[model samples]
Target: MYLYDHYDQAMVDARVAEFRDQTRRRIEGTLSEEKFRPLRLQNGLYLQLHAYMLRVAVPYGTLSGAQMKMLGDIADKYDRGYGHFTTRQNIQYNWIKLEDTPDILADLASVEMHAIQTSGNCIRNISADQYAGATADELIDPRPYAELLRQWSSFHPEFLALPRKFKICVIASDTDRAAMRLHDIGIQIVKNEAGEIGAAFYVGGGMGRTPFIAPLVKAFVPLDELITYSEACLRVYNRYGRRDNKYKARIKILVHELGVDEYRRQVEEEFAHLQTLAIEPPLAELERIKTFFADPAYEAGLSDDLDLSNPAFAAWVKNNTAAHKTPGYAIVNISLKPVKTLADGSKQAGIPGDATGEQIRVMADLAKTYSFDELRVTHTQNIVLPHVRKADLFTVWEKLVAAELAEANLDKITDIIACPGLDYCTLANARSIPVAQKIAERMADKAEEIGELKLKISGCINACGHHHAGHIGILGVDRKGLENYQLLLGGCEGADTSLGKIVGPGFDEDGIVGAVEKATQVYLANKEGEERFLDTYRRIGMNPFKEAIYG
Candidate 1:
């Protein structure tokens, strides 16, 4: 975990004090809602349908066990007993009292965390692969660069308010776990023919009403000039990005209207000019950040072995773990989806990324004991213990099982990414959580049978749940004053990223789950070998799924 120095601490403390005064004025009726809107949003506070929701940033999706415990304490002490982890690798407290907002932020600051930059039109939290330092497939650990971006973008005077929100992501692994291509700026660490490290820039990739898989703007940028290049890109967007309409303001839209060649040309022009200036951070600062992300020390003679006798444990291991760079270690994912349905026959998919206070607390303990006191949040709305020794697999599984945090579905249909739709968000037209719950309940018996499906649900067109990137994307709609859902097929957010295509007409609440079941049947019948839903869809095209749903 990256520890905050005095400078970082002072900056955060000052922001908290400033926001506390703003919160007081708002509560005292001196600051009107119109006046307080931007102020509150800048500090990661939002007035939802019923209450204020606070979003807290988890930089690079990384956290210490102590921070996780504080999060659990925050959830239990002030708001609900659980919190929802978002696709951006942040956490949301949906039931916040406006008066308690300042205190909650203070508590977060005490843990070296804050909600700053979680919202606002400025560059948001920089995210990366959860398996950053531990993954065997990575070319380099991306956390160093991501942390640099975090420091640079935080309260930068040049980009306090841009056309719309800007998101930047970095991925060192060839496999894109952080939705690298779906962000405003995506950094792919690469090596040149000379065996020197650099980055390939993917600019203007985003999903909203308009979706684009970012085009390559730069073939390669030297590692030392990463910040300078990013500044050049953001400068281009700030100057030329549309501001007349909110919907048309993103850099993605700008790139779409102006071809990739033109966009690249402008960015190159800016980069050339930026190179002359002394804007890039000192090399020593970046090296200092890298020290925080060094690989955890492992026992020298640990056995690279696993006792896989129990089928249950084996099943959990197979689904919830990934290969590690170290021979004796594994990357463990703690599934937030409830392992079983409630007494009311509803699966824990109501809010797919939610974790109870107790679960959070215990998971923190597990991290401290088994994972070098470090954990990370995945873009798929799950938590990752990135360096668990292979010898501790059974023990970790047992603890998770006892805490009811063990759900043996990672990329399967049950691991749904859902946004707080009509239930909590004022922007939503239909309910997202209930739809996720229904889909999970419908597919509980058939999860393993379906296998390796990315199911995402969004309340509205904002695509907060990233429904645009799911194998089966569910978008809630308001049709004739009634809640309905429109399904999409063949979308993926991996290394080969593509937006999903809409199937057909919308379906009512009662009909949507059945429609999903029909689509699954079509997939099962046509799938060859061990094909996933996305794999099978690619082979057969969209007509089969459209017909399965419509006819």
Candidate 2:
């Protein structure tokens, strides 16, 4: 985790003071709501359906145990008893008081965290692979580059008021855990034939009503020109991105309107101009940032072994853990979507990504005791103890089981990622959480049978839940003033990124759940040995699933 220096501390403190005054003025009726809108949005405050929602940034999805604890404390003291971890790897408090927001900001500042850029039409939180440093597959830890971009994008005067909200993702691995291609700017740190490291840029990828998998804009950009090239990309978007209509303001829209070749040409022209200005951060600064991310001290000669005798623990280890770069260490993913049995003897799904304050505190404690005192929030709305030792797997499992956090469903159907739909977001057309819960409940018994299915839901076309990337996606919409659900299939967010396509006619809430189950049955019946739902869908295509669901 990157510790804030005096300058960073001063900037956050100053923002808190400024926002406090802004909030006070709004409460006292001195500042009109129209005037307060941008000010509050710049600080990551949104007036939601019922109350204000505060989004706090977890940059690059990395957090120290102390920071995690503070987030829990804020949930307990300021808002309700829980917080929703978002697809952006940030956390949101739904019910916030206008006056108490400053105090909350101050609390966050104390832990070197803030709400800046978590909202607004600016470069939002820079995201990366959750298992960045610890994972065995990455070419390099992508967080450093992500952090570099973060510092560059934060309050950059040029992009503060882009036509629409922009997002950027950095990844070093060929496997795209962070949905790299589905961002406004996706940078994959790469090594060329010369063994020199650089970046490959993918531009104009996004999902809203109009979903697109960004085209590769540049094959290789040298490390020295990384920031320069990034600025060029943003400059091109800012210069020509749509502003007349909010609906078409995303960079993706611009790229669509202006072909990828022209977009690349403009970016290249801007890059040539930026090169002379020397805007790229000095090599020393990046080196300084790299120092903060050096691997934690580890005991040598640790055995790379786990005794998975207990069936329950063994299941958890197999499902919840990923191979680590270091011997005897594993990347442990904590699933927040555990199923709950109600008093009526029916199972209900725990809201995906919702964690109570106590649960957050427990996760922090687990990180402190078992991992390396560090936790990561995944873009999938889960948490990761990125460097847990294999020897302590049982104890970690025991504690998580005690806390009811040990759900061995990673990439499984039950591990769904969904957004707060009509429940919290005013822009939503229909409720998403209930639909997600229903689907989870319907599929819980067959989760193992279904296998490695990624399901996502969104209340609207904003794609905040990343429904566009799911193997099976559920989108809630309004039809004839009634809530309706649309099912999408064959989408993926991995290295081979693709947007899901709607299968057939929309269904009511119950109908949608049944339709999803039917689709799964189609998969189980037609799937070859060890084929994932996605594989079978691609092999068999949408017609079989469509016929099964709609008929």
The candidate maximizing lDDT is: 2
The residue pairs in collision within model 1 are none
- Over the stretch 1-551, how does candidate 1's per-residue lDDT look in tens digits? 79999999999999899999998999899999999988888888989999999999999999999999999999999888999898999998999998898899899999899998888888998889999999889998999999999989999999988999999999987899989999999999999999998899999899888989999999789878999999989999999999999999999999989999998899899999999998998889989999998888987777877888899899899999999888888999999876487798765554688988888999999999999999999888899998999999889999999998888999989889989899999999999888888888779879998999999998888999898999999899889999989998888999989899999898988788888889999999999998999999999999988877787
Clashes of 2: 0
Identify the leading candidate in terms of TM-score.
Answer: 2
lDDT (C-alpha, whole model) for all candidates: 0.90, 0.92
* lDDT value, candidate 1, whole model: 0.90
**What digit string (tens of lDDT, one per residue) describes model 2 on residues 431-480?**
99998898889888789878899999999988888999999998989899
Cα lDDT for residue 436, model 1? Answer: 88
What TM-score does each of the candidates earn?
0.98, 0.98
Clashes of each: 0, 0
Give the least accurate 10-residue stretch of model 1, judged by summed lDDT: 342-351
Clashing pairs in 2: none
